[model samples]
Target: MKRRKYPKANKMMLVSLGIMTALSLPIQAEEEIFQLDETVVTATRTEQKVKETPASVEVITRKDIETMGAERVVTALKLALNLNLSEASMVGNQVSLRGMNTNQTLILIDGRRMAGEDAGSTANVYELDRVNINNVERIEIVRGPVSSLYGSEALGGVINIIMRKPEKPQSTIGLSTGSKQQNASYHLDLGKQGKWAWTFDTLFTDIQKQRRSETTNMYGPRQFYNISGTYDLAEGKNIDVFYERMSEHLKTTDYTDDGGREYFTNTRNSYGLTYRGRTTRGNYELRTYYNELEKNTDQLEGPGSYSDFDRANYKTWAIDGKNTMRLQDDHVLTFGGEYRTSEYRGTRLEDNGDAVSTVTEHGISKSISEKSVDYQAVYVQDEWKLSDKLLLIPSLRYDDSNRFEDSLSPKLGMTYHFADNFRLKTNFGKGFKAPSISELYMKMTRRPIPTRTVIVIGNPDLKPEKSTSYDISLEGEKGAAFGKLTYFDNDVTDLIGTETTRAGSVSTSKYVNIDKARIKGVELEAGRHLSNNFTVKTAYTFLDAKNAKTGEFLQDRAKNRYSVQLHYDDAQRTGISSILWYEWVRDYRYKDDEDKDTDYNYGTLNFTINKKWNERYSTYFGVDNILDKKIDELVLEGRLWRVGMNYTF
Candidate 1:
């Protein structure tokens, strides 16, 4: 691995920080100040003001999304401080928060979980990308351990996407075209004040293939579709249903005349139903969901000779229920339970000189080509307002799985309002992730040639990975200026890895739990509204992540990262608004499969302008990665421009 210097970029970042800090100071002492009253529901399963929540949380409102001109959920997520996005050759993009692996973070839509792992124990972060940004009301991010409430995969934190509900009868249509993609969307609402209120939304997108160097499409063509509807049964009661589908086609070819070619196709379908209600004494919700994913690949040698065919299928079903009650004036109790099941099936066939034969099958046995697992969990939490200036929240959860040992997770948090506009908070939580079905039952063998054989086997005796996290923070707001500083540390044990063994000409690989890790970091966030038309926001993060046993730096974890944005609006007085954003990520170290290390850095600038024609129409234009910064290994395309219009009636 090699390291490069970027002194010019570093200087610019420092100057920008100084200017923002200076501008925020003058607005703090103004007599009339704007206060933020944003509310969020992911932190506690109940709605509460952002400032009153006991945990560290960040929110991206609907207005913010529109102002930023983000076309995908991943684009919006990257704006958050301390979060890292990586592009994988097969998985599209993977997201990591606070130096944790992608699998350690949990993703949710309307508080419902989605599938994370495949039959090969590989995490697919791109699953969240299927969501339509037009249907989103807002995004809430909680930046600490939440395993006590959500069960597994919460060691890093949680990202919850909330959908919009209509309050009046209206319809909206949107269309956009870009240098690399095209998009269209439609939404409608009817009978908002009646007992039979309903809302509908849909989106379609098409992305063209991107080339690398002179040839080879790094990213293939992709198409997506999503539909959702909600019906109101009565006051404080409703039922909602949603369905989404996507198809992708990819092709890659070698430059040589006798080179091989590969074609891949992927299709996914997901749907869910939710019922929720509220009463004088309590509130409750019930939800159920089903998801299916299929992948197919074909390989061809020179000209049109068949080489191989591979296919895989994954299915999941889940049901969950939750209830909240006000037991006393100072105590609010919440209870939840969930059941989930998943299955995986896969097969591979290779071509011989005379015929094609089955080469690999993934499952427990030949008779049972599909491997399945079931999981159950129950959790309870209490939010106690001990005093006017003090608050405490305690939570506990127990989980049972058919293939792993039973486990328990607990968390405790406290907040003290020491001053009129200031608060101190601290939290401690235990987190764990059970072994996936692929890590416990998958079996496969491959024979590339006549004398070489490769075998891969799962380890049913592997232990679950566990972590203990601690965080403390100081938050305050004075007039139009607000800021927060936080420090966090996490200790993990029994981390999973692969071990390889070789005997003569045969090679074998197996999964093992034999690693430990420790990660610590500091985060600082500050923002201010200078006036009715001008605003500034900034965030910075410093992380120290390493292997606990070997004392080596962790791979793919950046040491420094920051983001800054400047926004101006005329309050619709002038019918024009604009925003400028910049992000910097310091060089990070990563180890390749061949035992080589590399360091990389990226800096990008984005700007958007909006023009309002009237109350019923608006147009927007934006440029992404204006500086054209490139990372060859990440397959990032540079300098994209887009324009779009929205209509409402």
Candidate 2:
């Protein structure tokens, strides 16, 4: 690995340390103290406090989201430690966790999986934009392999979003405007005990295009809508349904002398239903869902003398069921099964003056082409309490797919209390990811001109990527302070890579299984609540990732990252509250077009102040990137000011 000199990085670290010291100095005078014991459910199928969970889990509460003034789910996720964001053309932004690529992370809503692939083999991070932040109760992140619970796509970790359940009648309306965007949202909850319950939520957002010298955005307007409902059938039985829709339209101006234009449009729809009940044995849930996505692009050049069009569509349907049982006082069991099917279709057309042709890969051209795949899986897990201070959990899963071979994954975890307020935890798990639809059957062509041609083909014989992960941690608490230190290692086999072959003048690229890769990292998180109204929190992460076969460092992974935040609530002592946050991301390396390492780094500061005028209304004002720190190519918008008001009835 190569190192680059960054003078600012050291300064940023010192700044954070200085702030912590300053805050601690004033704590000795304060007598009141408070501790946090946040509840989380993603680590296991059942709910438990973050401190009790065997795995390292992070929880982002609704109050945290509101204090940060985050308008979208992606914005809130960016604040998490060790998570990196990357930009992908046409497919929006992607996220990498624990030095693993985007595809290795699995995202879920209410314990159900989301679609894992896009039209061009890109990961589906953009789909997160559809989730209404105002309706979310909380988000739980488990940062390690959980394939024993989830089937595939859990090599990196899992993010589960839990929606709020309406218990009483209430309503809220909010509107916010910023330097680059505008948003409005409405939420209504109406219900009566033992009868029926319903919840309605909707949000609308608009973003303006931005352009700078040598750096411009081709993206355009976007909109999202979500609706959900629930009904109670009996004393312990209920049904829930939800629907979401998203769309975007974009146009880009040509930078060349030809003065060409490119138009692109993308739309997605998702809906699902779930039936839940509590029986004498335990609790059970059954769910079914469907999702569809469509993308289209049109290009015009040289005063309409040349034209081209491309279109792609993807759809998926799934059914899942799970049951939890209590066999004894100290033993609990959970089992689940799932069935899913997915389909993909794409078409391309080219027109040049006297001739019109359809572009294709491997001389197989058609107006429209289609492919489909199906999967079935079952899993079981058990939690055993060996004694008052020791606990053990074991999980296993089996999956069978029409497009690939069968797979089996297993995991074991243990937790032991070493002292009054300290515990030791360890986990070992196996994970796997099946080849995506686009990677297995996609047929696309690039640069269809006669002067130069490049074709991309999909290999149906590609094997599934697999991994083994191990981690151990020590966590404890004293008085009003809590801290945790963790170390983890993940080794992956049968890695997927793209191979290009050229015959004569035609070049072809296809997906294949490669050798081995490994990632090792250490994390430290500490926080202290000096008083009931004042608190401080910080985290640091160090990662080392490489390809074991080639001995080359992985691309686009930061070796060191850290975050610090200071918060004050006042507990309505003065009817005013404020929060100050500072974050610094260490320099990371990436391979440019010429395969040379390039370094990128930056830091940001944000502050928000809130005032509750009365019981009916409250207002907040905030400034993001107060120092105006930015990397033009990486950041979409910089140094923004926003104000918003919320009305409750």
Candidate 3:
């Protein structure tokens, strides 16, 4: 007799099928189930239940974050449908949603923009790793373009991190450690006392670096702290202020130097003040904020060449206000305006020991070599309840900038209750992403090989990237069962790419709007409850991404992806609990450092068990990548273990 070993993908499929079958068995649910009463504010700037939103939205609660052992926002979103995540190397750890590129995604904290690499790219991406989950109350994810509300980088989607604000007095402390990682966190909430309240939170994390022959880049320790306070002026009127800061150490081992390493620290600091009040028929908010990002090097122990620039800094300041009014029982209107300024500063050493940076705003002939830009935007939206079962929303926005042509974004959204416990939702919109300072006015010189020299230049005349987006879905919720099916399509133009012109051994590359593309996908998610203690959910996505002009498939776009989760807990919400999660990805292609095509598929399984000793103490333990899966040593980490304990008072 011979024994057969089943592949990991097959094992995942089997587990999924078994769970589906088990959910089909005849059994009565013991208590209330499904997400029916949850309210979200991102979709329309109005408080509405998840089932009433005009777009597809997913919410991750605080319980989900602790149960899954997710350290950061990126880890919690890894298994979500329609999101493409790269889990391999330090430089490639990014997530793209709806087949759109990484640069088009927007991340917000309490409705304010976060830091972007400080100076990482010419793109609009925030380092999701810097956001610790300790203070997060919930995360709201809205799929598809939301330019009508957020403007610019809202082309792909929006992710909003909502911090915890206590409804009652509370204090919590947590400690956790892993095979190569460790964390400590504290949170304190002072419930409203006579008209004043405040909150404080802090987190620290340290992890061992991942190195293969002392070449690949790595991640290091990080720290975060946040504080906020509110003062009440009267009934329905208040003033709020907040401050936050974070720092992360980034490292890369030097292969040329025997005992050398290169590293830099990314630091972010932000603060804001806001005023809110409600009248008899409307509510309004006015806010002002400032954010700064910088990169610092460690010149004492290693070389001072972690980035192209010796030092880099980016800063942003904004004043924003909005008001929503209820005119009639069936009519609602919302409008707002904002003014913002963004500046970038950098200096680099030349081959001759002199600093280089020329401030020119004209063309690629000279590096933008220059400074900053300012923007002003205004937007309006109208919502109409035409009938008992139909809702229509129309919105428009105009953006004016000092550097480029003005842009107008318009969107239309519809929701119809076609059947009991089910609704049909659709959204059509136009979105855009402004060219970054590094993209519009950049100039760089590089020597790739002994015989070749390359110079890269930026174009100041470049237009912003644009996209036409559409999505339709049917969502339903019933007794212990919930499901959704969605179809998304995005056609993009004025895509920014590089073009090379070679003369002899010297090559000149310039940025231009030289390409067009199309990204379309189908997403399906379904879940059911077996009883009060057990619940199961599964999601699948199929993506087709391509370049319109070349008709070639996009790099790193997986054709199929799947995830399944099984959860067990106490009916009273206090006792032992467990979560078993599995995810599989298939048919994806990527170009490695050497520019060689690497095609592969992989799966991972994770488990966590938690116990509550009493009202004040709890503990959890978990294992990730239980099968010890590995791919080319550049992807997922092998098996890892973690344990943690928490106390509340």
Candidate 4:
């Protein structure tokens, strides 16, 4: 028989907390909430218990994010067992589910799509950095096709970020600093102050990027802000308005032999207005929103000489309305329609050595190109309670767009309770994704020299990508333990990919349909409460992916990934909490330019501690990669430290 002893760090933390508890003000502690019986609103666009949903749904609350000491969406998403995190060429990080690319996974904020320069890449707008962590109430992840209600961009799954709704008056200010980053934020939540409730939040971050031991890509002074308010009109009726904005600038640290450097700037703005009404039989909502994004990048060949640059703008407008009704309390019927319009315009410099510093310096309209599309969609879904232990949901949607033919998507979901604490669920759905502006009508050319030129063009004849997806799961819960196992398969046809044609000193790359692809995977997740103060959780994912036409494996598609976490809380004592987490990844091998296979397996540990001094103050400390794990730019950058403090009044 043997017993493991606690680490010295744990004992030191407990002693420090005890001393603080005696010296600090008196306050009551609140237990952290984590269970499988919670309610979610994104699975079916309606409030339903997670355990009873027709599909697998995962949720990460605000408390979980704080406990992990995560400041970005990409970091927090690591906790989702069904998701795979990988590096993107442009954006630092992106996520995929069931081995599908991020473009197939729709990301929504408050149930609305965001506007950004897609540029035909899986990573869209950099929401990983723009989203204010302090303003997020919870994140809902539904794994499987949901195009029957969400239309395009749901071929793999859906991720919805829900904003906080204030019911009490409180304001908070926070500050944090790390070896490579610094952050500051303010949040104001005003409760029902004479029928007018509102919230305001802002965050500023500066991150110093690195390439091994060298300094570079340091995006600094990133600013973000959000403001919203609600006004009561009558019983069960209200009007809400919201506005958000983000801005940032980045420059490179390495310079070319010719004294050339890279620079870029980005800005985004979004606003919306919504009206909601509820009655004895049903609820209805009508809303409209506008989003705009601007981005520009350039390479400075020398002082005041801007070369190889482009300026782009994208805008989105949407109007939507939906109604949900209850019929005899057995069936919940929901119907919705939407009108959306998107436009993109961009211009690239024609001459690199012409000493042009700005896009408008030469009336760039001659080099500018534009594309736009309008979309109309309507959908209907019915959730039927067949009995106390059986549930059935059927939905259908029709979408029309100027760039693609009309398409119809249908879906079916069912859940059956076979035991007192166990449920079996299955889902089948068809999904659709229309080509983006860049993929459909892009025209750009680059001339590194007078004799050589490279061109990237679009294909107006490209067809829309479609997928047929299915998933089934078995879940159970008893007392303080719960577990879930799920299997998912997706078959996508007419996938859009690039093909290169070279002739002499000229090369052309065009977007085209690249046959079919198949991806399937298994996910296992389980958690248990060891005692009143301790909990443990583990998750694993296994994937099998292939290109149906060539039978080749998908690039960067990992075969095995897993994570483990152990948490402790002194909620009944000094209001302190701590967690130790570790994750490992392997089998995502790929061939390099030299035709050599590259495979590396690595794991790291993260530790964080949080202490609540009282109702109005709190502090936290954390360290990432305690073992000093490093993998160049693909993984961790050795060990990093962070400390934060917040005050509420």
Best by lDDT: 4
Estimate, for each residue in 1-649, the C-alpha lDDT of model 3 and write its tens digit: 1222336756666666566545444456434464447888887877777877787788888777777666667656755668766754546455577888877888788888764542224343346666768888888888899888888888889888888875678999999888646889999888888888998999999866655443645557889999888899899999999999998886666554444555678899999999999999889999999988886543322353322323557788999999999999888899999999887765321221224455322122222223677989999988889988999989999998998988899999999999988999999999998887666766666553448787766678989889999999988766777778899999999988888899999988788999899999888787787677888888878788889999877876777778888888884446878889887777676766665655567778989888888888888888888999876434666787888988999
Off by over 4 Å in 1: 7-31, 116-121, 191-194, 213-225, 232-235, 252-261, 348-368, 445-455, 502-507
TM of each candidate vs. truth: 0.90, 0.90, 0.90, 0.89
Q: Residue-wise lDDT of candidate 2 within 1-649, one digit each (tens)?
A: 3445678788777776565444334344545465467888778787677777788788998776776666777766756767776554334566677888778888887876665354334675575665777788888889888888887788889888888777678898988887655788888888554566777777777665555333344556677676777778787898988887777787665555356667778888889999999988789999999988887767666566445667667788999998989889888899999999987666622221112335553334445666778999999988898888998989999999998998899999899998988999999999998887777765667664446677776778989899999999998766667677899999999887788898877888877887689999998777788677777888778888889899887877877788887777877723667678776667566775468876667667888877777776878787878998755445435687778888889
lDDT of 4 by residue, 57-161 (tens): 889988777766666676667678768666543355565767887787888999988887565563443655667777888899988889999998888889898
TM-score (C-alpha) between model 1 and the true structure: 0.90
Model 4 TM-score (2 dp)? 0.89
Per-residue lDDT of 637 in model 1: 74
Q: Model 2 compared with the native: what TM-score? A: 0.90
Clashes of each: 1, 0, 0, 0
List where candidate 4 sits over 4 angstroms from the true fold. Answer: 1-36, 212-215, 255-259, 348-366, 447-452, 572-574, 591-597, 633-635
Score each candidate by Cα lDDT.
Answer: 0.76, 0.76, 0.77, 0.78
- Give the least accurate 10-residue stretch of model 4, judged by summed lDDT: 349-358
